[model samples]
Target: MSAVAPVRRRRPGRARRHRQRHGYLFIALPMLLFAVFTVLPIAMAFVLSFTDYSVIGETNWTALGNYTRIFHDPYFTTALVNTVVYTLMYVPLGIAVALGAAMLLNRRVRAVKIYRTMFYIPVISSTVATATIWYWLLNPQYGLLNVFLGWFGIDGPAWLHDSTWAMPAIVMMAVWAGFGTNMMIYLAGLKAVPRELYEAARLDGANAWQAFRHVTLPQLRRTTFFVSTLLIISAFQVFDQAYVLTKGGPGNSTITLVYYIYNKGFGKLEMGYASAISFVLAAIILVFAIVNARAVDRENR
Candidate 1:
């Protein structure tokens, strides 16, 4: 009779439930912070975009006035054009430089870590500090770049001061400062590529260029897409270099959407207009992101 006593089976569901509870507990703080800081601010900005809510005085509802004014605003139009131009130049050039650097570093060379560190140093450097150094280096008179050009019998332009050269100069500094990051990303992508592909290409009588074109490029498509998307987004938001170096100067040659937003919001105390412009910028970014996602999905399929 004692041996006939039934043994109760423990439920596996209980352990899963306990684990789920603990997981939620672990993530609760981060979720709270995100909701409070990120989500709340965004929601507030959206609401503020419809009102004449300058930092001073009573707020008044403006409906679509702020959004409507953006269309006729010459400064906004100029900023938009400048942003697009910067993007066109920066993205392709940035990707090329990064890919080239990555390829160079991908070799089994001595002191590779040192080289990597040297390239990455600029990325970790303070933006203000880098801008200051670049300011000195780009000075029309006695700047290192112009001095080197002088030795080569090529006269250098006033990079920051000249309207024609301001954007290009900013782009150059941006590419130099930014490509290192994308280079690291590309290096990681290059490392992840199956070595068998290269070997197979060689067996098929492919040369170095042929192997890279057929084997390497195809394998790195996802990486390229990711890098390009990031570059596009960052290019659209470009402000610091223009602000620090040119102040959107030489008749607003380098003024970007973000710099315009800054001037509108803080400089002119037009918070509602600034908020509207920000949302417009956000919409543009969303559209690009969606397009990139669709392209990736189509490629994957």
Candidate 2:
């Protein structure tokens, strides 16, 4: 009578299945939208990259001809080089400005929110509007930038008009417009850094610079990596500023990969070739991202 049969707990298979069904239903709309908008377009572009698929006329397969043509295309080469140069200049400067701004604002000083807002205003401003303002500022004559230069008896270059200065001008504008967001990111990272670490550093006779170099920077490695990766991608894909300011002009000195792709796809109606070049650009961005991720991982280890 005391030896009762052992009871086994039954699995909630039906309830679990019901919950999973709801989860799928909840995500169905977003999944469908992503598939239709992102996945399908990428697939179509890849397929079209293998063909002579201009918007008009008959389409025909061209195999790897489109890819091959990119290597020999002078405009493409120039655009690629310009894009690389822009990325090289933009990423470092953007990081420096953002980090410096973040460090400045991380203090317990009064009116810090006002300063943060002022810095972030440009990030929220429309790209077209920002570029327009910069356009006026960089004008060869009567612009504020050159006017200030003249106060010191310094002659200013024709920024957007001069081939030598056009890309640098774009880089400057982009950095000004973009660094605010990264500054906010850095601000968040700085906030997350344990205050105890700084106190510890102080107790160890470390000065402000030493604490920043050893503790602050080390703690913010992940944040720096994330910010750098984003900056690299955005810098590589730069187009709107160049389009609005110079229209890839001054002898193509300001032409970028995205600008070149736009000219090929829409301006020239060479969609297939443009798609091929775009895939190449995608490959380059992917490589940089992977390298950056690996570097972060190595540092963490």
Candidate 3:
């Protein structure tokens, strides 16, 4: 034993160790808060999804009963379908509108700052107020929308009241309220695009439209993907507009997954079912997010 000596691993210097500690200290509060607020709630919800914990009622373990019941739930099916439709409508339109706004704003025109402020105002305004405004504007009989439609001799249908048109009405309002944020994101992306690309395109006799299609679109691919993912996520979680404008009314046409979850958890006190639906929605969102990411990545390849 006296002839053998163990070699210890070297340790980091005091300054290096102190810097690492400081770095961890900087992140500790955020990680702690995330665990407490986000991770804990998700874990609690996952557990509750397997049990019949109806808030005030006796808690009972049902295994996969809630999840199994989801397949048979008509409301869930309708809500899921409605959510998909909303996402489909919103994601493309939102991207287009945001991109268009970004392009227009990128122009070095006079008073462009004021135009930006006006566009961004809705993004910061109260959702309730925005919904209220849209509600007024969408009035079939007394609304500005109908008035404008009537100018073209095209009678706008009862927007929020008509089941067929309700979801679309919601989509329009959401796009209007949200495109501002996406516009700013796209504006940043546009700014980052190399001016040399535009110059090369111009040198090659590319017009504005051609330049946009070839240079701008290709350059903003990543930004578009980011915006699409955000739009997809937000579209699936759409609750405020539907709840405010229609309350999932007009025969549940506007009933989103989140709205359905709220109705179950609060309205019917079916916390277990709500949690199960929430998890299902989370899964669906994950799938869509993955698909979009892969789709964009594939294009890159």
Candidate 4:
């Protein structure tokens, strides 16, 4: 009986513990870089928002002045309205087009890769270059768009030159430049969908449209959620296209929140005000992301 002592199992060795620590060490550099480039700047901007920093004088803390002014500023209000309208128009249309393209390309057809490459060209292309090209394309007198409109006996609006049509023009340009990425994303989503589900749907007498509605849509729900959320954020933060095309004109009709921030920071030297506006933009984007997440989760359930 005295010889029946139990042997205890030891914990993980020093080597295993060291490996875990080393794995975390590899991530440390990237985390530090992100903090430096992203986190620090956001914090600095938020602090600067409540101040009266200008090129003419030293930065002085002015509690709630910039934010209160934002509420009262007619130009900011106009930009806010324009941004919301642009997001509403762009997000739905972008998703529809991307999903359509993805479905078309998801088939077991020839030359699909080539089509994907062609579609994605605009997404990879530089925004400045694309904007410049579209600037001429939307030109009133001699642009290609108007030339096409002539076939239908429709006169094209002055895209960048007129206040009335400028925001619409921006939306169109953004959709063209941005939709390719989402299309590619959707293609990947479609590929991940199981073939058995489609076969089952077909055997159940579901047509192509019906199959897509019941099977494809459910499978791609996550992708749509991601794509829509990203597109909403990007659409809201739209700046370069408007800047390059209209320079926030004809009479500031195309002046979005980001463009306004740029003007405040660079043009007016109102860095504090610009920072406040930036934080507002961040809040809007966060809310949109949360709403999209909840919608997607509900669909999954």
Please provide, for model 2 over 1-301, each residue's C-alpha lDDT reduced to its tens digit, 9 standing for 90 to 100.
5898889998879989999999999999999999999999999999999999989999999999999998999999899999999999999999999999999999999999999999999999999999989999999998899999999999999999999999999999999999999999999999999999999999999998999999999999999999999999998899999999999989999999999999999998999999999999999999999999999999999
Off by over 4 Å in 2: 1-18
Give the per-residue lDDT of model 3 (tens digit) for 80-177.
Answer: 99999999999999999999999999989999999999999999999999999999999999999999999999989999999999999999999999
Could you estimate the TM-score for every candidate? 0.92, 0.94, 0.93, 0.92
State residue 266's C-alpha deviation in candidate 4, in Å: 1.2
Q: How many angstroms is residue 94 displaced in model 3 relative to the true structure, after the best TM-score fit?
A: 0.1
Whole-model alpha-carbon lDDT for candidate 2: 0.96
Candidate 3 lDDT for residue 216: 96
Cα-based lDDT at residue 261, candidate 1: 100
- Enumerate residue pairs that collide in model 3: none
How far residue 203's Cα lies from its native spot in candidate 2, in Å, is 2.6
Q: Using alpha carbons, what is the TM-score of model 2?
A: 0.94
Q: Identify the runs in model 4 with alpha carbons over 4 angstroms from their true place.
A: 3-14
Cα deviation at 212, candidate 3, in Å, is 1.1
Best by TM-score: 2
* Model 2: worst 10 consecutive residues (lDDT sum): 1-10
lDDT tens per residue, model 4, 145-202: 9999998999888888888888888888888888899998998999899999999999
